[model samples]
Target: MDVLAVSIFVFFFLLVTILGFAAARWRRADNLDNLDEWGLGGRGFGTFIAWFLIGGDLYTAYTFIAVPATLYAGSVVGFFAVPYTIVVYPIIFLFLPRLWSVSHRHGYVTPADFVQGRYDSKPLALAVAVTGILATMPYIALQLVGIEVVLQVMGIGVDEGSWLVGHLPLFVAFGVLAAYTYSSGLRAPALIAFVKDILIYTVIIVAVIYLPAQLGGWDAIFSAAQGSFDAFNTENADAIAAGEVGAKGSIPPAAAHWAYASLAFGSALALFMYPHSVTGVLSTRSRSVIRRNAALLPAYSFLLGLLALLGFVAIAAGVTVAGDPPNPQLAVPQLFENEFPSWFAGVAFAAIAIGALVPAAIMSIAAANLWTRNIYKAFINQDATPKQEASQAKIVSLVVKFGALVFVLALSKSFAINLQLLGGLWVLQTLPAIVLGLYTRWFHRWALFGGWAVGMGWGTWLAYGVSSPTQAHFGGPLVPFPGTETNVYIGVVALLANLVVTVVLTVVLRAMGVDEGTDQTQESDYRADAGDEGVEEELDLTAPAHG
Candidate 1:
C-alpha cells in the first residue's frame, strides 16, 4: 500500500464523515422526523447549494470512471455523454421548474407522489414507485463499482484471498456511508457535495491542463491515441472482420451516427426521470432556483468533456492495466497514480470515492422516499403520521444501501453495469406518466400504465438481445432499429412504441367513456413558488394533502 496516499485519503474520508453527521445541524430544524426535513433537507436549499448537490448527484463517480473508460477503450459513442448533458439542461430548464412548483405546492416528496396526486390511481403510482426502486438499485451498485475501482488502483484491496478479506476496506467505507446517510438524511449528501464538487473540479481541471502539457499537447495526444488504435486494428484485422473484436477509432463510423444521436437524445429525456434527479430538483428553495441551476449545471458538462479527453491522455501516456483483456476502468486512476505525486493521487482517489458517496446517499434517500410515500403510506398505512413516514424512509434508506452493497459484492461488476443500462431504459419508460402528467391530463391513467408496461417489456427485450464482441447478450446500449440497418438507442425505440400504445389506447378509453381519475392538482399549483398561499415554508404534518 502507498502509505502517504492512503493516509491523505483517510484524512479526507474522515473529514467528510464528520461533515456528514454534522450536516444534521447545518440547517437544523425543530423536528427531523418528517420527509421534508430528512428526505429533502427541509426543502430549503438555495441556488449555490443545489448547484453542487445536483451536479454531484447527476455527474456521479460512475460517470467519472465509465465515461473515460469508454473513450480509453475506443468506444466512439461514449462521448455522447457531453451532448446528452447539454441537451438535458434545456429540457429541465423548461419543465423541471414546473415540477418543483407542483411538488412544493402539494408536498410531494417523490415523483410517484406527484403521479398519485395527478392520476389518483394507486396502481399507476405503485408502478412508478416500484420502477424507481428497481432502476435505482443497479445505479447505486455502479457507484460502489466506482469506489471499488479507485480502491484497487490505490492498492488498498487487491489481495488474492477470501472475498471478505479483499472487500473489507470497501465494507468499511460503505458502513460509514450508510451510517451518515441514515443519520443525517439528504443533508449528509447536500453538505458533502460542497467538498465532492470542489475536489472533482480541482482534479479534472488539473489533469486536463497538466497532463496535456506533459503529453506534448492535444494534437500529440490525439495522434498517439489514433496511432494506437490503428496498430490494434491492423493486428486484429482478422478478428475484427470475423466479428470477434471491435474496431477502434476516435470517431464513429457512418453507421453509428443514428446510435450516437439517439443515445444522446434518449439519455437527455431519461436523465430527469430518475428519482434521484427529481429529488435534487424538488429539494431546491423555489422554481427560480431550479431554473437558475439549469443554466449553471451545464458548466459540469464542460467539465465532463474535459474529463472524457483524459482517456486520450491515458492512451498517449501509455497507461496499462493488469488483466487478460485489460480493464479500461483502471485507466483514469492509473493515469493519476503514474502521473501525479502520491499525495495528490490520494486526493484524486478521495474525490472519486467521495463522488460515489454523494450520489449513493441521495439515491438511497430518493428510493426511500419513494417507498415511504408511494408504497408504505399509499398501501400499508393510509393515515401514517409524518414521524412514522420519516421513520420508514430513514430505515428504508439503510436497507437500500445495504441491498446495493450486497449487489456489488455478490454479483459480477459487468452484471452490475448491465443492470444500470437497463435501469436507464426502465426509468425512461415512466416519463409519460410523470412528465406528461405535469402538463396535460389527456393521457388516461390506465393508458399511461399500459404504456409503461409496454415500454418496460419492449426495452428490456431489446437490451437483452444486444450483442457485442465481448458478450453475447446485453452487451451495449445501441441496437438496430426495426426493419432498418441503422442502430439507435433501445430506450428511444421503446418510448416510441409506448407513445403509440398510449395514444391509441387513450382515444379508445375516452371514446368508451372510461372514468378518468380526478386530478388533485390545478393550473395555479404548477406556478406556485415558495411562500405561495398553499406552499408552506415548513411542512405541516396536520395539513390536509389536498384542499
Candidate 2:
C-alpha cells in the first residue's frame, strides 16, 4: 500500500516537473534575458493564474501539514494561521496596489530594489536585502518540513538503504526542484500552480467532507477534538497558562482572544514582508491586477479556515498513529493515512509535495532577485549585462536552495519549527523598511535600522529562552504568563517593540537633523501608470541592464 502511494506521488511530481520546465515556453516570450521577463513573468500574469500562483505559493506543503498538526497537538495557536491569512488579504488590498505601481514604475523586481531606488540609500537597501534573506531561509526550510512530514507519514526513510536510502530522497527532491526552477524561472511555478491548487483543494475538500461521515460527522469530530484539547490543556495546563503574556518570542498560546488577535495581526504584517509573497505581488503587470488579487485572494483565506478545522476533525475522528512526533504539523498526513484508502492518501501526499514546489520556486526566485539587484548588481558588478545578471541569478538561486537544504539537514526537526517562529520574528522587523517605506519616506534610514536592530535583538533573546518537552533553549514557542502557564507568539511581541523603537528613533533622528535619505518618489508615484517617469523603457538590450 505504501509503495503504491509512493509510486503515485512520484508519477504526479514528475508530471509537475515536466510541466515546470516546459513553462519557459508556456507563454513563449521573445527574450527571457531581462529580469522583467524571468523574475516577474514579464510582469503580465492575468487574474486566473495570478490567483493560483499566489495562493499556491502562500499555502504550501508546510501549511497543509503544519496547520492540521497544530490542531492535532492541542495548541490553539496553530489555528491562528487561518485568521492571520484571512486578515492579510484585506491588508494587502490596502497597500499592494501602491507597491505594485511604484515597483512597476521603477522596474524594481524586489522590495529592496524599491528601497534602494526610492530612498537612494545603499545602507537601507542592504538592510532590506539582508533581512529578506534571513527571514526567507527558515521559510524555505519550513517547505522541507512539509515534505519531511509527508515522508515520515508515508513510512519512507533512510533506514533500509546503503547509499540510495537516506540521501537519495533529499537528492531527488532537490534535484528535480532545482532543475525545473532553473529552467522555468518564475513561469514554471506560476503555470503549475493551477494543478497544485486543484489537487490540494480536491484532496482536502474530499477528506474533510468524507472523513466526517466515516467518523460519525462534524458533531462527533468536534466533540472528540474538544476532548483532546481539554486533556492536553489539563495535562500541560501550566505551560498554556504562561503563554498569554509573553507570546515569548514567536506566537501566543492558543488559549484565548489575544492569541487569535496576535496571530492574525502578526502574520498579517509578516506575510507581505516575506520575499516570496512580494515576488508574487510584484509579478503582476499592472496596479489593477494587484487590487483584483487583493480582493479575490481572501477567497483562499476562507479555504484556510476550513483547512484549520481539519486538525480538530482529525482529533475528533479518533485518528491515531504509531511513532508520531509530538507536533501538530504531521496531523493531516497522518490522519489521511490512518483514515483513507492508500490511493487517496497518495493524492493527498502529492498535493503537499507539489504544494511545496510552487512557493519554493517563488521564494528562490524572490531571493534570487534580491541577490541580483541588491548584492550582485548593486555592489559586485555595476555594469552587468541583462543576460549576465540573469545568469548570475540562476547560479545564486541554486546556492540559496542548497544553503536552505543544509539548514534543514543540520538542524533537528524540532529546532527547524522554532526557526520558522524566528522567521516570523525577522519578517515582522521588515515592515517599517518595506511596507511602510511604500507610503512615506518620513523615517530616517539610520533610524529604520535602529528599530530593526532593537526588535531583532529583543526577539532573539526572548526566543532563546523558550523550552519544551523534547528540546531545551529555543525549542518551543516563547510564552510570558507566569502561574497560569500561557504563551504568546514572540514575533507579535517583538513587532511591538520594533514599532516603538522605529517611532521613538524616527522622532529623535528627525530632531537631530539627520539626513533621512532622499525620497526619489513623490506621493504621486504611488498612483503612477505604465507611461510615467522612470517606468521601464523598452530600450535596446545591446546596452547594459544597470539603472
Candidate 3:
C-alpha cells in the first residue's frame, strides 16, 4: 500500500523533471550556451517567477523534515529558524541589489569570479570557490536526507535490514533529479519550483489547520509539547532552552545560550550569502525583480512559521511512530500519514518530495558554475569554450549528486545532517571575503586570505571537537576557545574572529608596505541597471528557457 503511495509521488516528480528539462526552450534565449542561461536561469526572472524560485530554493525539503523534528526534540531554540528567515530579507535588501549590479556590470557568474576580477587575486578566488563547493555538498546531501525520510515513513522498503538497503526509492528519486538538472541546467529547477512550492504550501497550510482540529486545538498541542519537555527534564531541560545541544546531547547552560544566539544571528547573516541563493538573486531580469521578490518572498517566511508549529501538532495528535527503529526525521511524515486522508497525505508527500528537488537542483547548478568558472577554467583548461565548460559542469553535476548519495547512504543520517551544519560554518567563512568585499576592497587580498585560513581552520577544528554522530551529525554548538562552557554558532564565532584577524592584519600589512591588489571595479558599478546599463547582457530571452 505504501509502495503505491510512493509510486504516485514519484510519478508526479518525474513529470516535473521532464518539464524542467524543457525550460531552456520555454524561456527561448538567444544565448543558451553562456553562464547566464545555464548558470542563472537567464537572469531575467521577473517578480512572479523569482518569488517562487528563490523562496522554493531557500525554504527547502530539509526545512520540512528538520524544523518539526527539532520541535519534537523539545528544543525551543529550533524555533529560531523562523525569526532568522524573517530577518534575512532586510539584510539582503541592503546588499543583494548592489551585488547584482556589480555582477551584472562585470559579467561575473560566480561570486568567486567577482572576487578574482575585483581584487585580482587568484588565491582569493580559489578560496571562495573551494569554500562554496564544500559547504554546498553537505547542504545538497541534506535535501536527500529530507526525501529519504519521506520515503522511509511511507514504507517504501519496509522489510529491509537497514536504512541503506531501504533507500532504493530515493535512488530512483535523485537519479531523475540529476538527469533533469543536468539536461536543463538552472532552468529545470527554476521551473519545477512552482510545483514544489504549491505542494509545500498546501501541505503546511492543511496540516496546520487540520491537525489542530484533530488534536482538539493549539492549546492541546502546546500542552502535549510542554508535557513532553517536562518529562525529559533530567536530561534535556537546560539544553532545550538555549538551543545549544544537538538532538539530545549533554551541554552546559551558558554554552547553549551563546550557541543559540550564534546559530540564529550568523545563520541569518549568512543565509543569502550562499551561492545558490546568490544564483537565484542574480538570475532575475531587473533590479526591481530582486527587490520585489525580497518583499514578496516573506510569504514563505510565514509558511516557515506554520511549518514550525507542526512539531506541536505531531505531539497533540498522539501520533508516535511505533517502530523501535523509527527515524526521528519521520516526525512530520508520520504525522501526516496518521492525520490526513490517504489522498491528501499523498499530495503532502509529493509536496515534500518535490520540495527536495527545488534546492537540490539549484545547489547543483550553483556548484557547477563555481567549478566551471573557478577551477576548470582557472587551472585545468584555461581556454575551454562555453560549450566545453557547460559539458564539464554536466558531468560534475552527476558526480556531485552521487557524492551526496554516498554521504547519505554510507554515513549515519545524524552524521549527514551534522556535515550539512558544518557546511554552514564553512560557507559562512565567505562572508568577510565575498559579502564584505563587495562594498569595499580595504581588506587586502593577502589579509583576506589570511583571515579565511584562520577562520576555516578554526571553524573546522570546532566542528571536529564536537561529536558528529551522537546528535545525528549536526554537532553541538561551538565552544569558546579557552572556556568550553560558553558555546556559539561556529559560523558566527569564527566569522567574527576572521574579521578581527583581517582588520588587524590589514593594518599591519599596510604599515609594512604590502601591496593591496588593484580593484578594477568602480563605485558606480555597484549601482548599474539592466536596460540602460553599461554592460553586455548574456541571455536575450526570445522565449522561456527549457532543456
Candidate 4:
C-alpha cells in the first residue's frame, strides 16, 4: 500500500464521517420523528445546498468510475451521459416545481405519495413505491462497486486471503455510512455534499488541466486512443465480425446514431423518476429554487464532458488494469495513481469514495421513506403516528444499506451493473403515473397501473434478451428497434408501448363508465409554492393522507 495516499484517503473519509454524524445537530430540528424533518431535512434547503445535494445525488460515484471507463474501453456511446444530464435539466425546470408544489401541499414525502394523492389508488401508489425500492437497490450496489474499485486500486484490502478479509475495509465503510445516515437522515448527505462536490471539482479540474499537459496534448491523447482501438480491432477481427465483440471507436458510426440519441433521451427521462432524485427536488425551499438549480446544474454537465475526456488521457498515459480482460472501471483511478503524486491520488480516491457515500445515503433514505409512507403507513398500520413512521424509516434505511452491501459482496459485480442498467428502465415505467398526474388526471388509475406493469415486463424482457461477449443476459441498454435494424434504448421503446396501452385503455375505460378514483388535488395545488394558502411551514404530521 502507498502509505501517504492511504493516509490522505482515510483523513478525508474521517472528515466526512464526522460531518455526517454532526449534520443532525447542524439542522437542529425540534423533532425528527416525522417524515418532513427526517426524510427531507425539514423541507427547507435553499438554492445552494439543493444544488450540491441534487448534483451529488445524480452525478454519482458510479458515474465517476463508469462513464470514463466506457470511454477508456472505446465505447463512444457512453459519452451520452453529457447530453443526458443536459437534457434532464430543462425537463426538471418545467415539471419538478409542480411536483414540489403538489407534494408540499399534500405532505407527500415520495413520488408514490404524490401518485396516491393524485389518483386516490392505493394499489397504484404501492406499485410506484415498490418499483422505486427495487430500482434503487442495485443503484446503491453500484456505489459500493465504485468504492470497492478505489479500494482495490489503493491496495487496501486485496490480499491472499478469504473474501471476507479482502472486503473488511468495504464493510467498515458501509458500517460508517449506515450509522450516520440512520442518525442524520437526509441532513447527512445534504451537509456532506458540500465537501463531496468541492473535492470532485478540485480533482477533475486538476486532472483535465494537468493530465493533458503532461501527456503531450489533446492531439496526442486522441491519436493514442484511436491507435489503440485500431490495434484491438485488428487483433480481434474475427470476434468483431462474428458478433462476439463490438468494434471500438472514438465516435459513434452512422449505425449507432439512433442508439446514441435514444440512450441520451431515455436516460434524461429516467433520471428524476428515481425516488432519490424526487427526494432532492422536494427538499428544496420553493418552486424558484428548483428552477434556479435546474439551470445551474448544467455546469456539472460541462464538468462531466471534461471528465469524460480523461478516458482518452488515460489511454495516452498508458494506464492498464490487471485482469483476464482488463476491467475498464479501474482506468480513471489507475490513471490518478500512475500520473499524480501519492497524496493527490488519495484525494481523488476519497472523492470517489465519498461520492459513493453521499448518493448511497440519499438512496437508502429515499427508499426508506417510500417504505414508511407508502408501504408501512399505508398498509400495515393505517393509523400509525409520525414517530412510528419515522422509527420504521430509520430502521429500514439501515436495512436498505445492509441489503446493498450484501448485493455487492455476495453477487458478481457484473450482476449489480446489469441490474442497475435495468433499474433505469424499470424506473422509467413510473413516469406516466407520476409526471403525467402532475398535469392532468385524465388517465384512470387502473390504466396507469396496467401501463406500468406492461412497461416493466417488456423492458425487462428486452434487456434480458440482450447479450454481450461476456454475459448472456441483461448485457446492455440498446436493442434493435422493433421491425427495424436500427438499435434504440430499451426504456424509450418500452415507454412507447406503455403510453400506447395507457391511451387506448383510458378511452375504453372512460366509455365503459369505469370509476375513476376521486382526484384529491385541486388545479391550484400544482401551482402552489412555499407558504401558499394550504402549504404549511412544516408538514402536518398528524394530517391524514388525502384520498
Superposed model 1: Cα runs more than 4 Å off: 539-547
Error (Å) of candidate 3 at residue 215 is 1.3
Best by lDDT: 4
C-alpha lDDT of candidate 3 relative to the true structure: 0.80
Give the alpha carbon lDDT tens digit for every residue of 201-308 in model 4: 999999998998998989989999999999999999999999999999889999999999999999999999999999999998789989999989999999899999
Weakest 10 consecutive residues of candidate 4 by summed lDDT? 538-547
Supply candidate 1's per-residue lDDT for 160: 75
Cα error of candidate 3 at position 277, Å: 1.0
Error of 1 at 364 (Å): 0.2
In candidate 1, the residue pairs with backbone N, CA or C atoms under 3 Å apart (3 or more residues apart, or in different chains) clash, namely none
Clashes of each: 0, 30, 22, 0
Predicted structure 1, TM vs. truth? 0.97
Candidate 2 lDDT over 412-493, as tens digits, reads: 7766677777887887888887788888877778878888888889889888987665556786545663344555667877
What would the TM-score be for candidate 2 when compared with the true structure?
0.90
Better of 3 and 4 by lDDT: 4
Residue 363 local lDDT, model 4 = 100
- Give Cα distance to truth, residue 498, candidate 3, Å: 0.5
Off by over 4 Å in 4: 539-547
